[model samples]
Target chain A: MSLTVPTSTTLVELQDVHLSFGSNEVLKGIDLKVNKGDAVSIIGPSGSGKSTILRCINGLLIPQSGKITVGRTRVDELKTETERIALRKRIGIVFQQFNLFPHLTVLENITIAPRKILGISEAEANRHARDLLEKVRLEQKANAYPGQLSGGQQQRVAIARALAMRPELVLFDEVTSALDPETVGEVLAVIRDLVREGMTSILVTHEMRFAEEISDTVVFTENGLIVEHGTPDEIFSKSTNPRINSFVNGLGGRATPLHDGEGI
Target chain B: MSIVLKQERAKQLPFGGIFAAVLGLTVIAWLFLNQSLGQVLLEWLPYLAKGFTMNVLISILAIAIGTLIGIVLGVMELAPFAVVRAPALVYVQIFRNAPHLVLIFAATYIFPFELVIFGNYVPFPDWVKAVVGLAIPASAHIAEITRGAIQSIPTAQWDAAQGLGFSRSQSLRWIILPQCIKRSLPPWMNLYASITMGTALASLVGVHELLHSANDASTAVQRTDFTVVVYLTVLIAFFLFCYPVSRFTQYLERRLASR
Candidate 1:
């Protein structure tokens, strides 16, 4: 598909966003940007606020203070649930738990949002859903309930369900974390294909090697702050920061030299 | 494993044993009565049957009305605003804890016997008042059941629906309530059985239900043995009606748990 906006255009920008739950601060003065069609990955340890950033970008969590601009809308200024819902409609998010509606068949899960919110005809919605089912390589499971599918298959259906909205950007929150080890690859492969198709994506994930392989930019966050961000090569292989080197080496189990232009 | 399965199956429905016990007691009572048992039963069966039908009708009407209002109250209990939620919580708490017989009495005396409709005085019958009386506790119990069922749903479902851009009302209508119905079914059936048994309480208010009919039969017969047989039949009648419902609820609970 052709790019709807110029590749240089910034699709999402967060300026010094800070959010807290009770007294527990999660995101502290964080700034991030995603250019149109760029696949950005945020990686961090548990409780590092990586997933919280994705939630904030999609208006699921509003920052206590700061500007979040997605396309033309100011997310922080969204005063009502109606405005938040409007913002959410344009952005799709896949949860770590793959929260497919257990009561719905896979096809119905994929088609419901388009038919209900977008006012698409049933036939058209089904047609689109079938196409998504094929893209996710689960065409035969369209009539099956989510309970009948494996974890990986359920996550794939969740992705299709999100894509059915034709969202401008999609957020993936550790989409493979809940999967059985053997099944995680299938979900990741589906996401890899989506990234290759030039979809603008922001992912919060723990799959270190996959992030290094797919991300246009890799962001490392620790204790509710972004510690470092750069191209995958810079963050993974060339960064001199002891913490970044330790995190990458510790998670990925790679022994690449910390200095630029140094061999393994 | 086979022994465990047998025990589980044995625990599920003891209908045959209950039936045998009722039959044996009735036969013992018949032997003691010294009159033709079949003849006495044949004469009183039609009247008892009419009263039993009234019991069934009341149960059906009460459950239908209670379910409708209870669902609304259940949803209200979860409303974001305290103004909408507080009254619903108060209603469920008061009615649910109150005695069923007391509610029946309250409904009997509190509501005016006549209702003015279009300037016409329409007499509200005693049985209809009994239905309203029984419905109060039924609605409160069902409201609690509905709330619990909705809460039992994983919050992930709500998040998914919201992330997909479905409004709160739309999510409840399309996604949440459909699941709630399945989860609520077994308890709802259990409530129905309770309400069916509670219909006997209506007898105190002159509703002419099964117990009332049995009371009249005993008084008119003027024999102690005949009274025992009459009241025993009333007990058997209620057991026969409600036992199956409880069994079916168990069946549903098992099916849902497996799924």
Candidate 2:
């Protein structure tokens, strides 16, 4: 399939990205560009390097050979940890585990980066954190530690924490996979709100319906390569690629293997 | 209802049994070893109490220096390069494996009594030597504790902190070390207790600490019959000082864990 470049200005771009762990290659010669205000969903079977792509974008896992650019920052070329940290401030990531600082309160968790990394005043950071908490509908839990919150509440707080940095790009790495079925909607609803607000984001998710509804672009990966990329409707319903077809057919909140008794 | 039931169960604990047992032991000891007890308590105990300050001073100095060294060694142990990690590993192994008494004797005998620093000759006492000896071993143990606590924190926290733009030091200071403090407290208390006990070894090198003072008082009193009373009083004094510290450590551990 031919890759179509979006008309809007590019916010993130990955060129011929390749990453491997020991002998197993996770991402191979992948190319993708995310334009500003666009929400892209990466969906695939378990080992399709879907999460690895998000991790690469966020600099959690550096690509061995690739050019990853976020805005004007060439993330792959960052030589120092100091430079990487400065680059990371422009990008936010929400993890599946909702890795909130359990030692800190909800307000502290959200306000910490702004105050510590950005060197903002405590009063200013707290004010911004309160606004983000109110946006996530969790203003009352400002003093509550992450341990006291439910899985969904914790994920929302994580999202709020990410947003409090005012990052130009946000990445969601299976944010709902660890939550209970009933709680997934709250986290997804927060993402949907982000899409509505035209925040640039890349989400690796298994929820096909949410992906279809919110994503401006849909990417289907199989065996470390993007096999299909297009508008959500075209890729979700009108895809002709056999691998993409099999993946969408198994889109009942799970990625079924294309061949019986064989893994992806 | 379950919370109320737990509170009630805690209230109904058999504290009276513990009180009775302690009282019974005290009475048995008093009856069996009663001769010259008043003399030991009134005369010698005050003299022994005089050395308590020295004991406290040694412990404070040793811990302050030891903890600082321990934290540095701990970070070094986790360093990515072998050049940085090797010396820390060697220091920990040598210090931790050596006996505290041997270490104290070696420090007192081997280290120079006076050193010139900044063009000034500073005299080093037996107490300073003893502290150095205790601190070396304590630093090794604390290094091991710090390393374990830092390693026990999940890698995901590190990744999350990095994703939020925190450098290695920033992640450690704000995210990793704060979490480690809860895990490290109990071991730190245990180390301090051992160090406090190790301070008793200072008496061997003529530091005149609590045990040394007790020995001198016992000899001056010249009461071989009151040996048990004098020694037991010293034991009680050490126990009273250390038990409260351990209990407070446990309390903090439980409280932090619940949080």
Candidate 3:
């Protein structure tokens, strides 16, 4: 399959971003850029601020200092929640916990954002949601509630819900981290399909081999700083930085065999 | 296994068993006193039924008004600004801790006896005042329940809603409050039962509810046996109304816990 031409247009840029929660500095002077149609992945140990960076991009957490540009809006400069909400409309984020609305059916969950925020008609939103559910291979589960679905199934619904907004960029924050080992592969496969479709994605993931397989650029962060960033081959195999070398090899040593089973 | 057995044993002797035991005791008391329970009920049942309806009407109105005000006050307590939260907090604290009888008395006196509507003097009934009084404390208790219910929802729900571009109010209306409704139902039903029982206090202010009517029946009959029978009837009426509510609340709690 031929991939779309990767555009040079920058979709998100963060310059010297620093964020702290009450004296504990999380993201210390971080800088990064993601171009349109590029799949960038951030790999690091827990508490290394990989998720924090994703939160900053979506305007969920405000940095103490930095310039965050998403599309044309300066995210750091948003003065009110309304402004931030407007910025967020163009960005979608999936969390490790899935966080699907338990009270709503799968179809309602996916259609709610477009119907409520975008003022799309219910019929149109439902139609669009059905399409997205088909894309996620969950068309059969549309009427099922989140509680009725498996964790992997719920995460795919979350992804479908995000896509219902037609966002320019999507952030996946360790989405497979909470899944059972047997179920992780199914969620990863759905994400792989999304990334392959030229969706601009920034993933904060712990899946070493999967990241290497899909990411155009792989960033390595430790202790609130991006230590190095380069092509997947460079970061996964060719890097000489001892920290990156040891971390990659250490994860590889404990890595389980990839389960390509589609059944969740 | 022991705990499960204990729970099963506990479930075996439910409200019905206790109610049957109480009825047996009442029958024994009636036999010893040589009083005819049927005659007493025949004479006063109609009058007591009228008063009981008053209690039900007041309870329905008070709960409706209280729930509306409570939802607003509860949401206010969670407001981002202290200016909005402070007054709601103070209101909840004041009414929640205040004596229900005192609030009933205050409502009776605070509101004028009559209202001038369109140049007409309209009588403001005591029952209306009682409803207003009962609603104050009921609203406060409900506000606390609402606040707790909202807080009990995991913060991840809020984060996910925000990331989807939902405004805080939109998230609360669409996502948070729907879930809160289930969490709040058991407690809210418990509150309604208490509020229904609290309607008896309206009798002190001459609202002519079930308790007030029982007192009137006892005074008219001028017999100790008649008084006992009428008062017992009043007690049974309240139990009949509130017992089912509490049982349903427990059922809802168990279902929620299972989920």
Best by DockQ: 2
| Candidate 2, number of clashes | 0
lDDT of candidate 2 over B163-236, digit per residue (tens): 99999989999999899998888779878999999899999999989989888877777777566566766776
- Candidate 1 regions exceeding 4 Å error are A1-6, A254-264, B1-12, B15-35
* Pairs that clash in candidate 3: none
Which parts of model 2 have CA positions greater than 4 angstroms off? A1-7, A253-264, B1-36
Better of 1 and 2 by lDDT: 1
- DockQ metric, candidate 2: 0.73
Write model 1 residue lDDT over B1-259, tens digit each, in one string: 3356347558754755677587867666675675676578669989999999999999999999999999999999999999999999999999999988998899999999999999999999888998998888888999999999999999989899999999999889988998897788767987898899999999999999999999999888787867877777887788778877766766765655433
In order of TM-score, best first, we have 3, 1, 2
What's the ranking of the predictions by DockQ, best on top? 2, 3, 1
Give the alpha-carbon lDDT of every model.
0.87, 0.85, 0.89
Please identify which of the two predictions, 1 or 3, would achieve the higher TM-score against the true structure.
3
By summed lDDT, which 10 consecutive residues of candidate 2 chain B come out lowest?
A: B8-17
Model 1 chain B: which ten-residue window has the lowest total lDDT?
B250-259
Per-model fnat list:
0.66, 0.85, 0.81
What DockQ does each listed candidate score?
0.63, 0.73, 0.69
The estimated TM-scores of all candidates read 0.91, 0.91, 0.93
lDDT of 3: 0.89
TM-score of chain A of each: 0.93, 0.92, 0.96
lDDT of 1 by residue, A1-264 (tens): 224433878999999999999999999989899988888999888899998999898888888999999999999999999999999999999999999988789999999899988899999999999999999999999998888899999999999999999999999998988887677777887888898888899989877888888888899999999999999898999999998888878866643333122211
Which CAPRI quality tier does the interface of model 1 achieve? medium
